[model samples]
Target: MAVDQLAPPPAVPGIPLLGNALPMMGDVQGFLVDTYRRMGPVFQVRALNQSFVIMAGESANRFLIEHGEAVFTSAESFGGLDQQFNMRVHVLRGRPHRHLRKQLAAGVSRDLLAARWDDVMAVTDRTLRSWEGDPALPVVDRFQRLAADQLSIAFTGASSAARFEQLRSAFELVLDATITGKWPRAVLRWPAHRRARAEILAFAREALEQRAQHPTGGPADLLDRALAATDENGQPYPPEVRAGMALQGYFAGINTVAYLYSFMLYALLRHPEVLDRVRAEVDAGGPLTFERLRDMPALHGLVLETLRVYPPAPGSARTVTKAFDFEGFRIEQGRRVIVAASVPHLLPEHFPEPERFDIDRDFAAARKASVYAPFSVGGHTCLGAGMTEVLAVATMATLVRRLTVELPRPERPLRITATPGPNPGKRFKVAVSSRQEQADYST
Candidate 1:
């Protein structure tokens, strides 16, 4: 590893000005995977005026995951977060990030979802009930609403659209402008996004005030536990920190739920045999408990396979605080980087018949070996990964067990909308052909 010269990563060929931004944005996964094939794991691409070094494949993944803390810092790329929120969870770096994660984990933990399992099922039931007479319903919208209601209830003890919609309305715009950087920076001042930002901050203030007064300690909701969270020194956080951190948990995975359900349902429509297998597995498994869901390999594989085929996000953006060399390429300090975390899913070396959707493929082995980390690993891993998985798996199971439906165009493409997060575009919808009665899972 010593004595070799390190050079800058190779850059993708692109026109002047816009650079590779158009193609990359138009078909991100395709562009990343294709460029990876031609340029190898370590390379460069420019988007608008911004440039990024793309790190991908197995070795690249290992380097990033194992040494991410040493080489990278997300605090800058997340955009004006400190001034607006007074706290950092996802984008903070080093000791601060670790300490905050430990604190926030309690509020956004998977166990919270388990404790509220009945609410999840009931929410699914209500959403399904709403789709009764509709011939064709957009799975994306239906599922997004389902996730919003469930998350709102889990975080704030409110599920009705009237209450939950307060958190969701224009949330995507605010998220894109503030967190994801999908929208231009100037978009933040657009009257609609400005209103959304104000509403969000106001909602957090009201929620904090209400929760502080009530403090009705039964099972702790997100805000209650978040309010009680302390630092590594056992010091309580400021009100702004408490509110911002807790609110992040409130609307974490609506997009994932929307896309996951849409793709899984779309796949089920295209492959009837797989549908039969899933239905059979679900029917054989009597109660839909958290423990039981974990044991069902068929369902687990289905979700995993969908992720492999259609990841909600192809990669994540970060800024390099320290220079690092990978595959003989020197990633200089202060460079923007895109970790194409899911790019390995396209490599046949890691996955046999990579295009084929075989749920039984040993993805567990790949995940165990650290060659397939969809939610990322290490200090900057997604805090709500557990919460997201539980919500997604349960909703999918509940959907499969309850009703039968049809996708009008099983052959329709899975066009992705990357803003807010990647979801199947509205054109991806299913026609409900039948219904089932409300379910009572508790005995």
Candidate 2:
């Protein structure tokens, strides 16, 4: 194919210097979806003074993930997160990335997560009980904090009230700052960001020191696993690297899990029939045991559907390392190729009636077709996928068994934010009443 014949993807013209940065920052998902509709599967949009080849659907996902290392590089793509994540496992490439991924994978292994079931349940119960007195609560904020607390406990066994609060505060500041994508590396120089980073590093350092003092035979949590983690050369990463990786876990677990949980509830509340089915499954399944949670396929499907509709991280990107032909476009080296994760889910070809929130959607077929990976796909797939699902299942089961939540503004539409995830802004509030109270009131 001639180079001239294979032109750049269709692009939405931009302002003088700003390009499409402002519009994208305002509503990333909507902008991308609208562009996809007008320009087809492949298009281009300039954001933040840089041009990105925006690719939609399953082929884009496969290209970005399966051939990620060969044709693209995560280190270049996620370099912006370097200061926040300290170029941890997620951002690294090649052997170091693989080694770190292997180590982190073992930490959140099925066996390990299964062992931490009691702790997860305890945290969930405590969090739900904490919301008892409140009439209306900001579900996102509360769930974010709850997720952070559970992650702190599950990852580091950090139980001290003061420590947990400090961790939560630091994570909140850091997450809020980074999630908006408004704060670049320059923002790190600000005192607030500096303080948050310092506090996180201090916490991680303390945890590392404590672990060093009291090493165990088996890994108790992610911290311990990272501490004992060795690279391909049989060399353990330095304390700072380990700590940075653990903080990365905290960052991902807290935000992604919380958003997914909140969206799951939002989806169920909108679909009462689905909510009833999930509740019945939970009620009949008895206690929310790990095994039972797995058996409840309705709940599982609900989570998957929620993920498809409101993906926590809606888009991811890769920087082309070597020139290659993708979907007829000659993608040159050094360009960024962006993949809108939720686009495949919304495609009519892949999903019939894509707008409908169907819990019984054929997720198996979707997965087989490479159309439904909310946690991402291929080599850099989320390490916390299993743990995240377990947390969501436990949280839903606990809430459904205990309370009936009502959205104050059920008719209101969810507004998307600039955050990487599908944050429905601050308008998502819910009123909670005990199941007994709700039943009595109905009677």
Candidate 3:
């Protein structure tokens, strides 16, 4: 097949060097959607001397995720991540990627998570209690802190307040750098990034040393488990490898979980009816156990709906490795292919009235059809998906049951930031009161 004979997907023309870089940084989802409307599901857009072939909608999603490995590679797609951090599972490819994912999955396995249920509840309760005196608390900030503390406990066994702050700051910098794809040329030479990385590494090294000396009777936390993990050949991972894996897991859980918790709250507050139904389910169910969380259809639906509407990570990219024809267009090898959750989640074909937040929507069918991939799809699906859902449901149930949340500005829309994740730009303040206080006032 002659390369010239094959047609390239439509490309959005832009400046000579920068191309659509500015627009992409400004409004990534909007830019991709607009281009999709104009050029259909498969089109190309140039950004900073590179061209990306974006594939949207259900078919596009299936092709990009399920069948991606055959024609695409994750390492090349996420190459920029190397500049920020060591090669984590997300940025690894082929056999190494599979091995790393398998090792990491042990940390978030259903049984492991169930064992730590009490720890999760305790942290969440502590966080909520600390906010009791404040009449109006910023939901995002509070949740971010809560998530950092919870993850620190689950991943590292224990973390001081100072360590938690350091981890949060470091994760934020790495996340921002990866999303923007414009890190300072010197990379870790920047004082803040350098300091943050050093702190994270120091913490990881200290935790590893402690685990090695004590050899906790049982796996105390994810770090301990990773340290003791052996590959298929029964070879233990090096100390640095274990530390890097632990740090990567910590970074992954912190920001993503925080944003997910915030979005779930935002969605529930905006829809009081849904909130009431979820609370009723929680009350009737009694005790927010893992089983109870799974049993409550309303609460489960709300979490799924929140993810569908405001996915923490909106889109993912892959680098084409083999020439393939997709939907009548011939895509050449070495092109960057993007599959956006925002696109399929908002498609009228997959989701009728896609923008509307309806918990009762038929997500089961949509998921089976590959239209709703909030945690992503295919070979690289997030290992933390199950854990995040469980924790979010449990936390939200506790919130509704113990306290009443009142949005100070119900009329104001929930605005998201420009980053790939569903981070809110404005602070979400809710005038919260105890359920007992509300009951007494009503009487």
Candidate 4:
């Protein structure tokens, strides 16, 4: 129903200027969940000088998925996100946005992964193999690097793996700041972050130069796709321009895949019975392929369950360009709208025994019902989402098949740190053993 009245949505009472920024920053997901529950689906939350109209639950998800493009654009909502870098697809709208997204789409697509399957497994096998050497493992660090290496393999080719390994900290810092916004923008001024900025630009330049040096018709990665760009003038843009534009492709996740992997491991280690079931499922599957991996019910279920319990970046924010009305409340133009997608994940109506982490639950059906959007919805749905699904299932299966991992304190509940998004905290370290060593102990 359209409302001509200028009455805003119910306000979430907060302090005058700073508003709810402190609590919002402290636990963004928790704040969102609580506010949604308390204030109902549509409410206004102010943070600092900003006031955001938060739309929660399945209704919000559908609204964004269906009508988001017409009413919202991310440019202002995510202003200054580009920072030192020039343009990013996340902030663009209309033709320019679609153009860049199309270019980025193919490189990160599932098809490219299938085409480069050998390198994908090699990187996976090598990374997991490295984990066995670490007696006291920080799965977060290892998974963070693994994600970067995987992106390198997917984009710049496997030869850049060593280069990526050397630049791991740079990627971590850059992605942590850029993709996740976990660190305040001030953190970018640090000496180390400056070095990180240099390293990323250097990495981009080196990848471009190497491509030129040996122009083999290899499977086009994201970098290749980015370099393929031509301006509206129909002339190729300058190297520096393309490199800046292509920087987003190098993302390895601060809170995205990095934390997702950590949480998956945390969940599995927490539930030994589920871990054993997954291990058995992995064992029964002779050779793991995407299709074969999906056939492994327990493994698939574990992956899905992990996502439900610990979504890395659960909410997507957009700025309203044109005013719109929803549920009798009029959200004005220039308002910031946060689609609180995580709310439905824990809603008892959708998820029975909402707090329990059970593999038997059907989150896919929940997702089908528009209540679970782990990768989010609308024009800006995550590009790497499909790749993440395959990586999650494949990496978890591979980890269980080749190695055994144990938490230091298995009985202790997980403590989360929002490095801008939900992540398993520092205490979630693990002890690793090769499967052969484990078997020897059994023998």
- Give the number of the best model, judged by lDDT: 1
Tens digit per residue, CA lDDT, model 4, 1-443: 45557578999989877788777765577778888889888999887656778899888988987898898877764544455544467777777677767777777887787777667777788778777756679877778778877766766665444555545555455445543445655776888768767777777777777776777597787777767876544678677657755665565332487877888888887788989888877776466665675587787777777777676667787888888888779999888788877778878888898788899877667877878777787778777877888778888888888898887677787666665567776667888878883221100
* Candidate 2 global TM-score: 0.90
Local accuracy of candidate 1 as per-residue lDDT tens digits, 356-379: 888788877898766676676566
For candidate 3, give the lDDT of residue 25. 69
Give candidate 1 misplaced runs (Cα > 4 Å).
Answer: 1-5, 80-87, 163-166, 178-181, 435-443
Worst 10 residues of 2 by lDDT: 434-443
User: What local lDDT does model 3 show for residue 369?
Assistant: 78
Better structure of 1 and 4 per TM-score: 1
Clashing pairs in 1: none
lDDT of each: 0.74, 0.73, 0.72, 0.73
Error of 4 at 165 (Å): 8.3
Report the poorest 10 consecutive residues by lDDT, candidate 4: 434-443
* Candidate 2 structure quality by residue, lDDT tens digits, 35-149: 7777777888876646788878778877766777888776665554555546377577788788888888777666776776687678778778677656679988888778877
**How many angstroms is residue 247 displaced in model 3 relative to the true structure, after the best TM-score fit?**
1.3
> In model 4, what are the clashing residue pairs, if there are any?
none
Candidate ranking under lDDT, highest first, comes to: 1, 2, 4, 3
For lDDT, candidate 1 versus 2, the one ahead is: 1
Which residue pairs collide, candidate 3?
none
Point out the higher-scoring one by TM-score: 1 or 3.
Answer: 1
